[model samples]
Target chain A: MGTGTGLGRVRGLGSAKKGAHHWWMQRLTAAGNLLLVSWFVISLVRLPNLSHAVVTDWLSSPLVAIAAIILVANVFWHLRLGLQVVLEDYVHNEASKLGLLVLLNFYAIGAAAVAIFSIAKIAFGSAA
Target chain B: MSRNHSRPLSPHLSHWKWGANMLVSILHRMTGVGLATVGGLLFAGWFFAAASGEESYACFLGLLTVESGAINIVGAILGIGLTWAFFTHLFNGLRHFVMDAGAGYELQTNRHWAIAVVAGGIIATLVLWGWLLWPAIMGLVGGEG
Candidate 1:
């Protein structure tokens, strides 16, 4: 009884082979976002005000600087994941969906890179 | 027994997969709600800082950090809730992308992944809080000396 047939036996049976990779990526991003968001909130809370000097000073700290960079990157990456699903669900046209996905990834990656780079320059350039 | 179109019995929740896809769907909604709220708060913070002088900004800061106060309480609640929303959404969102790629549809594997996500979220939150609060703790200790 156990030695069943061919393809029919596997139809809608078990694991979706690729699902674990998605699961793992989601978990990884979640973990990263958790750390980044917490740091961002606390840092924002501690900041004195909108004063340019104060804002710069807050951002100048090595810890805050690095965290900010990470936070921005994580945020964009997370946003990409979210918007991808929204696009997939709503945009029926295959071309449009694929285009949106590509645009989202490009925008996220570019924005994150810029944010990280700018923060790094501001935080470290003065010293050098 | 002619045709009856009322509906079949609902499956037990416990027996349901409650797996990656389900988890991701739920988290997307949760995070959307959270992000909306947080976005408002964020803009408000900026507005307050811009409008009032340094003193007012300081007051806002004090309200957030001061112990045993309404503002602090609200801050704490938002902090935890937002953290959960962010982590859950991020993790589950990634899961959705992977599913789009056609993966992880196994029953047993899905269950394990769901459990892992929840556990991972909790642990990550704790670690983040610890890192963020360490400086404040050190400041308090130094002040006492």
Candidate 2:
């Protein structure tokens, strides 16, 4: 059920060393997202209510917190990689491209950190 | 490569017949970018509000639905739109996974599956939303006491 092995077979353009690595990670994260996000949404829909207590209690569970953290990590990683390709595709100026890539990295890392920290805080009952 | 004056230029979309697969490809990219930006920011807001305390969490929830005066319309639209976008990316990504497996490559198969991805996303979004909001929808029809 891996995406990279199949994509790797069709890598005429993405066959370069770094390209292959990037391509592989993208597929890995994509697969991770498919599973993790499905879990997230299904659980969300099943929640009796989205009240603070209910949500906090849910996050307080070790398994939920751990999965949330991993989901955030994988999501942001996939996002950064995918957006990198888009920026590299549309924004051709060397300076602009480099600047944007840096900005993208910062955004992905910063946002993921904030979300993960928030989830951890809830998991620890600090936000209660 | 040399350019020739008044010669036929490189053909683009206008020169080719439009197909469902083409739309599917474009939509997959669009939905990916949209889901990442809009869905990511919205999720960040929800998580931050949750971590900030109950008051913040309630405020966020209020704004998300019709309970508050703030951003309800925008929030409601985004709720459904992001759901659709998310489903679109999910189905289309699945389509890629199948293609990666060296199946569904026939012209008709490709086009039908492309159409299926598009249609499947819409159907799934509707189904999920319909189920979740069934009570609210029923209430609107005075089905609730």
Candidate 3:
């Protein structure tokens, strides 16, 4: 509520010194997921086949691999932020809530890592 | 002091009138959770299978496809359910963005948007899947003839 640019104020970097950083990032990544996931669906639909070779060939392209990695990152980030809100709302206990939040971080990061690694592997090993 | 102070409680679900808006609001969360868990794992599995080599990829496809190369029942169910969830969340999320921009608060407007979003999500899913599953549909249709 205090003086500063609207962006700084919403960022909680204003004189009031509060922010909606988490909430802001959630919305930001949601926008990303919307685009990336749509690309995934449409691209898959356009593919001639779902066979391993076709899929691998698709991901082998640098552009496709990059997009897939970006999609994975955005999806996992949004998943973490969205679930964090749900867990915080429903889990009343401080300790239990913290634990679940921590576990959520692990799962999101791990899954994203695995997915990205797979794409990179296909790009380097098979696609090459 | 903590024990002596009673926390104020907000009204729960029973306090609100149930409507399409409420249903969509709840489903946004429900479908989000479903996609985060089942859809997330399945996505990771697809990538992992592809990276593991041709044999593993074939094995993974085997789980999703039948001898006729049509999607198996499990695959079809999961595919439909996931698509519905995906589009529902996507549409409802777009609705939230409009609301966040400080419009669409009228009761009639909200109700209409809720109905439209739910219907639009289903129609979008069917349209996309219909195109993708045309071969499978024809396969089954030919058998009946």
Candidate 4:
């Protein structure tokens, strides 16, 4: 028998040292979501119109555009982290879990990319 | 290294009575999944429409919140559902982070926080929609008077 304690023997068998980083990032992004989402909700409420031109015009503002980008990025990252914990806890099949996790990452990245691209298109496109 | 049969297998839902805390925890995960999947798709669509041009953007707006019609009814319901999901998940997630910081572990406090998350989420959604519809409501009132 190894001299190490029971938990010590089993610890490294399941995971490495990087587990804390996921927890930390989840919390950090949660805080970011709180702030950015508050801004988003309040901004939407204040908008005078939801019409295409007016909405796009509002998004064109530099600060709004940057904040919107950051909000979507942080929101999606936080979302992915949360879903990961659920999947890890519930998924019994190793291969299936791995497949779903890979898909989740791509989905989040792709969704965030589309949102950022749309914001950029509006913010930088011709004023007319 | 032999498997210890004495260790109880994974705890299943049937083994324990359902409680408010458990419900909130389950909902937190469920909403997170919903937001990532369904919400993400609509979000991509919104951005794509905006980037495409004014006509497409108008169509997207019509698809979501157009006033008065069958499509409007369906879109409104989906919009409200999405809004509620967003608020509930956001609030409950904050509560989870707070608990992670080593507080609110007492049974009473845990239940209270769970209830707060539920109630607060509903109220937040209502107030947001109320603000969004305030002008329309006022317009109706003005016309009636």
Candidate 5:
């Protein structure tokens, strides 16, 4: 598992070039998730209450909104990349793997859009 | 660009004895999925509820909170599990960061790191839940005693 062989070694096909890029992105997003999620949890716990007004007010801050945007973006990207690996590894059927991968992309984008839209509505709108 | 039908496949799970490292790998994937599905819904729901208005917000909270007024106890359970998943994923993710950097690859060291990931993730999850519930617990104890 640690080493490669034959044509793959010569051509750098599977785990050499493109795979390296995926690996890098995963690590990059992992680091981002680590920092942003910490900020998210801390900010959440520190809130005086979880009421609508309180939460909206908290998210209205420019800094919090920015951090949240980054958090959402990184999380979804990391999740898509991670799930891609899972599907690739376990899904032997080519058609099913491709369909699932497409669905995964759409799901991540769609979900993140909703969350980001909600955050934007709070941050840009008049303080609640 | 030729596929090799005769090429050997990757080793099956049964080939190796189960270890924490394997568990960590599986947990990372499971928790990742759980967070994206359950946690993402909660994340979006909270924000959307807040933006929608007080009524909608209250409706959402009714599903999320632990009060008697809660519409669904399962939501609360899912929320708690989401928190644990988040923390565990986070801690284990950091351990993965070290591994990604091309460190801690030795057999013994890898196992040790895997144990740390599991222990640390669980401990972190417990500590967070404890902190969150401590106030409520104190109120209950105070009322009783």
Candidate 6:
């Protein structure tokens, strides 16, 4: 193997893959979370009481239901992205970093799923 | 491999620009932790209010409202924390959007936008607090009659 050939290859090289999609998603989810969070806060403040029936009634509204779903999804997505960056920055051990990243993704997904399911049950089920 | 190993690796941390991106990164984590803590507290309050009787719920409301100045202080802290979290996340989210659209990559633009984020956060917090307090002020004056 000649050194000259390897040098030429290195000079012309780019990354083995692209990460634009991931970057785009991180931004998109952040934007979504921003909007959802504002709605969530305002809605919470507007709620007159914390009675079960009242809570359910508010959630059962079509607009509130949709916003809650989006809020849950975007929250989880943003959490995953933020945690991934923290892991990448602080964890030098590749194996550990990857493991934590996988775990974080699963946790975020599970939490969001549970939240959405609870909201749906409260909003659409007989409880409402 | 031997020759490559002889060269020292460049410091990864050194390349990061200690400006808007860094600030956003740190704020993201801070707000995340803040949200989690506040969310947990809110959830606990919900659970307590749900499980307990109306008396307990009334007590909770009392603490949130007609209590001593300490309660107001706590409320203010939470309100400010929440306001900062919201605005920081919002501005940084917008920054991410612009970056995604292939703008603001230049150094000067990046710094300019970073400063804007800081300013936006302050202004947003002030406006939100002002709005929230307006009702309280009206109530205070109205009650004096």
Which has the greatest DockQ? 4
Query: What is the lDDT of every predicted structure here?
Result: 0.62, 0.86, 0.90, 0.83, 0.81, 0.68
Which of 2 and 6 is ahead in TM-score?
Answer: 2
Rank by DockQ (best first): 4, 3, 5, 2, 6, 1
DockQ values, each candidate = 0.05, 0.59, 0.67, 0.68, 0.65, 0.22
Alpha-carbon runs more than 4 Å astray in model 4: A1-15, B1-6, B67-71, B134-145
Proportion of native contacts found in each model? Answer: 0.00, 0.60, 0.63, 0.77, 0.72, 0.14
| lDDT by residue (tens digit), candidate 4, B41-124 | 887778778888988987877876655522377677877788888999989988988898899999999999999998887998
The residue-by-residue lDDT of candidate 2 on A35-98, one tens digit each, is 9999999899889878888898898899999999999999999999899999998887889999
Error of 2 at A26 (Å): 1.0
Over the stretch B5-124, how does candidate 3's per-residue lDDT look in tens digits?
A: 486667889998899999999999999999998999899999999999989988888887887678898888888999999999999999999998998999999999999999998999
* Residue pairs of candidate 3 with colliding backbone atoms: A12-A18, A12-A19
Flag clash pairs in model 2: none
TM-score of each: 0.47, 0.86, 0.88, 0.86, 0.86, 0.68
TM-score of candidate 3 to 2 decimals: 0.88
List the pairs of residues colliding in candidate 4.
none
Collision count for each candidate, in order = 7, 0, 2, 0, 0, 0
Choose the strongest candidate by lDDT. 3
**Which of the two candidates, 2 or 5, achieves a greater lDDT against the reference?**
2
Each candidate's B-chain TM-score, in sequence, is: 0.63, 0.84, 0.87, 0.83, 0.84, 0.67
* 2 versus 5: better DockQ goes to: 5
Q: Predict model 3's lDDT versus the native.
A: 0.90
- Write one digit per residue (lDDT tens) for candidate 5, span A24-86: 898899889888988888888898877777888888889998999889889888888888888
lDDT per residue for candidate 6 within B1-145, as digits (tens), equals: 2346777887665786577667766786777656644653453454345334446555655555544322376567776877787687678767867886799989888888878887788898988787767767677789642
**Candidate 3: clashing residue pairs, number:** 2
